[model samples]
Target: MITISGLTKVYESRGRQVTALDGVDLHVREGEVFGVIGQSGAGKSSLIRCVNLLERPTSGTVVVDGVDLTALAGKGRRAGKDLRRARSSIGMVFQHFNLLSSRTVQDNIELPLEILGVSGAERSRRALELLDLVGLADKAKAYPGQLSGGQKQRVGIARALAGEPKVLLSDEATSALDPETTRSILQLLRDLNRQLGLTVLLITHEMDVVKTICDSAALMEKGRVVETGTVGELLATPGSRLATELFPVGGAATGPDRTVIDVTFHGETATQPVISQLSRTYNIDISILGAAMDTVGGRQIGRMRIELPGRYEENVVPVGFLREQGLQIEIVEPQDEARGAAEGEQAEARDARQDESQIDKQDAAPAATAPALVKDGAR
Candidate 1:
């Protein structure tokens, strides 16, 4: 388990001060895949860097398993043996697989155990075991240049595990991979977390990666934690502007005669018939313009764009009904003003119809008098 409290980091450049982390507090339980997400300059990098003492925090503390790493600062040379021992229990995989190109896969993995002064026979055995764990047993003799992006990452993971660390820090581990490869690597990380009971801290800008492996996540913005919650809770509400990055639906509205709504389906609502039933019960015409659905922790989360053929006010009934059914609904506003102007045109057309009806009645009166006059003349 890892705990970060009041973590703050500031940098000075060209007479300007930039805060990388601002009093950030995070608690990651043992065996949990915790994701830290944010855009560029969100202090995600700074926060995690402070975890293993990679970047010393300007304030606050980084505690791992009851040991405050910040307190151990500057003991690197004097308390050399202790520093090595503490770091041995924490494994790190970087964004760029920093493997020694000159060393073979086996040597790269064995490098950590070698540093830990593990026995020769034990290092060889552990390196092979790690290679198997990462599904690269066949590439044990290959060099970094010989492997693909995913393989090099696997090698990085295996090398990190050589010390048999209880905590694994992944720094954009899959960002460089293709979508498919990213998925595979994330799955592998999840499997490793469960299999090894490893506490993982994964830092990335990709919310999809967090949803895949993290049970809980914290959204960082401008070096501040804007949102933090279980994946389920975040998906259910997604209230924080930072949270909506995971589920985004953008579209232009047609007219005020129609209401455009962005609906997110998660958990039970994903499997429910809320959308269709709401439309049918209201007897409102519903048109779907766009949709996206994907699996997170084996649960399906979908976003649908619906256009209701009626006034926006009229669709409020159905929207309330949907929320009652446990759907997160947000009304989508059109970029164009025509979406609201259509109602005015409808009113004008109604007035025109009424005017036509009145003209018919007046014309009937004239025709009736004309018929009588004609009869009188004939008589």
Candidate 2:
């Protein structure tokens, strides 16, 4: 429900201009979790902040559900009544939780309602419902200092939903948690997406987060979006950098005679025994160098690097056979010299075949030269 066009963000630090976002264009559909991934300085943080107008764009439009937030706030850093009213429908969860030290979990969740002039009874009731929604019902009275990192994030999520926003912007929301906790938080987000039909736009440096929860993803580099698509689409795309980053297959050294190929398996193909079928059909030994396989969005997706017995020229048919089975194959190396020599040999064989054809034609014709040689013997 969020559409961003030509969005740019620039800041000045120490008299030097820093561009955090550059002509970014993004669309996040309603009721889906979209992820933005990048390294430290790729400006993913700036992109998400601009979605909710937490950071004003240098130019361009930020439209959510047909409302242009950039126009509502005017061209300034301050938040006017119109902007704040618009922001109340958009929830933001920070990496640091951003909870008040003196506030209990319930109080923290109720803070937004309090500022919105909600009645005390209604605020308490909504806070309790949200705490239960985030599975933090028992921690309602617990202070932020008494909660664990994951628990604190749960409080943050609950507080963000306190306004019953149609959109949720998560800025590295699970970056501070442990692996197990991260999975739990991700599952929580997934559940929330299904239950509340909340549209999530999350930015993270972790590939696992995208793999585990995101339905669609964008890869950012140096303030530019280099790649974006559904997880399966990205995996099926040839030479997709995001696919490689998401499913990393290690490289192994191979002898000159061996051919290495990377095969991508998606959907039902991931469960197929295509590798074994190739070995049986070609009677050639196959070695797996590395494999990265996982289930994304309840579907199997994987990449496997394998080595075949002979060079690519000898195994072209076998690779084609694998491709016929709906597997995406990429040759990691090409034996150029060997292929050239083979082509030369084929050319020589073609010349020899032409000479043999001429001799056969001469033999089939009347043998005049044999008759001349036999005359002396007959006399």
Candidate 3:
């Protein structure tokens, strides 16, 4: 379990203070795979780094497994003995497989134990065990360069687990891999979470990662968490940004006097023919504009945008009837249709600009200035 409160991280760039995290408050429950998703500059990377005290927070408290890491960190630039000990139980996997190039897969995994003063025999045994656990037993003798990207990541996961950590922090662990590899990695994380009871807190820009493996998720924007909740709760929430992004049904009322409504279906309601039932029961023709369906955490979820033959006032009875059948509905106000369309376009343009700016900043930064771990590295 992990809890972060009032977490803020600021950096000096071009003689100006840039806030990477702005008062982020988040909680990850025990044994749950929690995901933090955002675009570039949303502070996801900074938040994960702060969790392990790799990047000390400008102001905040981080508590992991009931221990206040911020208090242990104190005012020191480097982590003290207490904080180091605490970090041993918190494993981290990086975007780039930070494995030692010269070390074999087994050696990379054993390095963490070696630093902890684990005996040679015990380290060897543990390394082999972890390799087997990560399905890399046969690749134990392979060097980092010899392995594929997915294999390298598996080695990284094995290395992170060498300490037998209770929590796993993943910083874009699958972003470098292809789609198939990414799915495999997400499945591996899910398997690890269930088998080892590891509480995973991963940060990614990919939505599929969250939909596939995360039980709960938080959406970040402009260095702040905008939405956080269980997948089910979010899917069932009316006008949920996460839900809309996850299952987008895009269409608007094409003509005046027609009412457009967005409906969310989940749990038992997802299986029923709610739309057909509504139409038949109300004796009204429903025109479906768009629909999307997907399964999350083994439950089917969907959203639909439909157009009714009348204004919101005229369709009130039918909308109420749909609500009675346990569907979340949002009536699109006809008066604000044009304004909302313009605002949506502007938001999209703004997002594109922000993304381009962040990419430029990243490209301009020197590789040598990138953060590196002293010991117990990702690999």
lDDT of each: 0.83, 0.90, 0.91
lDDT of 1: 0.83
Clash totals, every prediction: 2, 0, 0
Top TM-score: which candidate number? 3
Q: Model 2, stretches more than 4 Å misplaced?
A: 334-379
**What ranges in model 3 sit over 4 Å off?**
335-379
Each model's Cα RMSD:
18.9, 22.8, 8.1
TM-score of 2: 0.85
lDDT of 1 by residue, 160-253 (tens): 8888899999998998999999999999999999999999999999978976888889988888998887777776663445445666554555
- The C-alpha stretches of model 1 lying farther than 4 A from their native spots are 14-16, 74-83, 257-259, 309-317, 332-379
Local error of candidate 1 at 211, Å? 3.8
* Evaluation by TM-score, superior candidate among 1 and 3: 3
- lDDT over C-alpha atoms for residue 263 of model 2: 95
lDDT of 3 by residue, 12-121 (tens): 99999999999999999999999999999899999999999999999999999999999998786878899999999999999999999999989999999999999999
